[model samples]
Target: MTTTTENRHALPTGYQLQDYRLISIIGHGGFGITYLAKDTKLNHEVAIKEYFPNDLAIRENDHNVHPKSHQDKENFAWGLERFLQEGQTLATFQHPNIVRVLRYFEAHNTAYIVMEYEQGQSLSSAIKNKGTATEAFLLEIVSPLLEGLQAVHEAGLLHRDIKPDNIYLRDKDHSPVLLDFGAARYAIGSRSRSVTTIVTPGYTPFEQYQTKGDQGPWTDIYALGAVLYRIISDKIPVEAPKRVNAIKLREEADPLPPATKIGRKHYSERLLRNIDWALEIAEKDRPQTVSQWAEALLPPPSPTEQAKPVKPVNRITPATTSAATTRCGSTTAT
Candidate 1:
């Protein structure tokens, strides 16, 4: 994840450097390094995500070389295809709340994706900096996030990793933008026997931990619920309750702090109820689509409420102003 392009003969910095001027390092993760760079031709700042192709290729090679059986080789190939496919799939989505992928290419034996540079703190950082967000603020942030998820849902993409860390808040415009489509899976695709469980433990759905089953919108819904629960309670939900022999055991989950505790004083019961519904254990019991969950939290206005008549204000003219001025006796000489 090192951002230094100094030693990379394949990626030298200068007028001759590959189409971009590396400004500085931005962020780094296990997969690759992200650089805040300027597009030479476009003269716009962009985020350059350079994937560790060597690592991926090496990992693929290792899996092939040290396979326990012939089946292991097949599994390795499947995983490689999936990893590449994810990058291709993310390239297709174009939404305002979702980070835009400008370009995708390979250099120095590594694949790189150029994207919009989002200047903001992640949801995790906001929580850490502010301790806990107010209920209204949480709703403001989450509503837009859900809208972004809806776009992904419509595109047949399941964001397997939908956690606070992946939700960014842009300070410039005060809007939430979803990030990290690396773990996104296409709904309609060939099933590869690749068994890579890509998910964060507490934020991920229970079904994700299972070795088998098709992941879909419902799976993303579970993660969305987990994100909201954390924002509201400031406490991550405990792992899905486990069952014991002959009895279905469940642990007592922590209740959300009262609105009074946060000094909001008054709030809607329906909103809280919807939050709980989204966090339900059974996927079938939860809201099926992102839009459904969003609508539940943000219910439509009643017909009577919308039918209310509007009142017009009286107009103040120059004549009225002149009369008022005369009454005050503010004129000097003509």
Candidate 2:
């Protein structure tokens, strides 16, 4: 979905689902609807995602979701299983930068994944409010997100979606939290073998356009690079398919301008270059891992600097030292 659209079939407010009581609809997409809910047992708010693929299912007067047609029954069942699996996988993650999944369960002939409700605005909204985010601002958000993404990769999963809209900046500290994972969406699309449901235009890498394309950490790197591109240039990068066509014609014909040329004056060369490197059209050409990409953004150690043995510096205060001295100087003989 280009934007979160209204779902008329969403569970009504105050409706009970296991321990969660629906408070309001958070968002809806092709595959599901997320709701802001209250956990009655815990007496806390949480986000709950309900499986309701619009294409294959419908909600009846009784509020139970069922396959729209007999033909969709198998696909819906398969997708539901994958959705449950997605919830299970997410529940295992404990990273601060990734949304925390509390629990998941089946109800009303469907499934729901309950997650911690975060207080923040989306990166897209943040970008829209503050035009062309500063490099320092973007780094503070991106660095921690990369660590979270790296953790996802290590767990043998891919985000598939990494646009600005999917990133949330916590209101408390403006720290980025990766949200709305596309695992179930991708899994459903794979089961149905539909490519249209997979790509997110400018943020999607060219490999995802193919039916059997090789996807890995680099796929997410491209999307993250595109997000940074939007923040720096105030425009989304050209669609990956279009970029692929341009590259086929000639290197100079590539439509997406290099970040180095776009933001060099305002941002550090290393930062811009790292963005450009991640945005490389070919998977093999981009940095293979988050560490590989982040290291380039750091200033290299000086040539004259040599490795020294580790040392511990004193962190005591003079006032505390004087107080200790006074205490040791004299004592009452009790």
Candidate 3:
């Protein structure tokens, strides 16, 4: 339940980032802060993400980014490059479910990526307002999300941070759009392995906490699975650190309780199993791809739908046939 929550450190309403005028603070997190701004030239709204790693850097009164100390210079520069790279990479994405990256630029002694201002509430807000959603409704939201994530994977990118708050349910038709790529998060991983930047307790997989944690498409898949679990159960999955400690203390016990046990009344067995598979403590046990995880959501054919089983009538076992032959040989005909 305890996840990282960022505070407001946005520029004043009239302040400008190039041609975009800052309107209000939209989102703030460990890695960066986003703002609702108007592109004066284009006359449209855009979300601008500023590369400000709160742990290592701070925004000065003059709106210039500076590291906390001389010690953080290398890490800050490295992260800024990674942030710019993320923008460049995200700009290439054209999927409807993936939030389009409008443009990226350097200013205020750091970098910023411009994005479309989506008119919708986050999945987290929607769930809080609507309570537990039905399985069908969950599938409708999860399917497009996985497809979009698959596109991200194909492009050799990993959405390291994926939580309910990061997914937006658009107003137009309730479409899901993924937000926030951990721009400065990657470099900070190796820069100082001891330090923690962003931690979305329940949604974040165990491997992500480690600096050398082996991650792949499965990493994002694990998060997506958690999102599905949260939507249907209306409960945050147990945090990874707590789960780890509990698991170690009781080797025989399941650290993360099965979703089926918690959401049996609301969800089908098949649906719960898929969620559990993704929440598996071991990475190898989880679905390696988004499609692999989503495939099991659909239940298999029921017994009635399958071919009917035929009962044996004239069939006999070896022993029974031998006894019948012996009786015939003894002339015990009836």
Q: Compare the candidates by TM-score and give the number of the best one.
A: 2
The stretch of ten residues in a row with the least summed lDDT in candidate 3 is 325-334
lDDT of 3: 0.75
lDDT of 3 by residue, 1-334 (tens): 1112335455666687899998777777677888888999999988888888888887778978899988788888989999999999999989888999999999988999999986776777666646556766776677678778878987889998898878876666677789887756867766777435655778878888887788898888888888888777667788877787777876657566789898898888888888888988778989887666655764443565345553232111111111111000111100
Could you tell me how far off, in angstroms, the CA of residue 129 lies in candidate 1 after the best superposition?
Answer: 3.9
Instruction: List the candidate 1 regions with Cα displacement exceeding 4 Å.
Output: 1-17, 53-84, 184-197, 241-267, 301-334
What's the CA RMSD for each of the models? 13.8, 12.2, 17.7
lDDT of 2 by residue, 297-328 (tens): 53443343324332222111111111111001
On lDDT, the leading prediction is: 2
C-alpha lDDT (0 to 100) for residue 168 of candidate 3: 75
In model 2, which regions exceed 4 Å deviation? 1-6, 249-252, 298-334
Put down candidate 1 lDDT per residue, 109-173, tens digits, no spaces: 44567888866667776665354455556566766677677778777777777887777666565
Could you tell me which residue pairs clash in candidate 3? Answer: none
Count of clashing residue pairs in every prediction: 0, 0, 0
Each candidate: what lDDT? Answer: 0.57, 0.78, 0.75
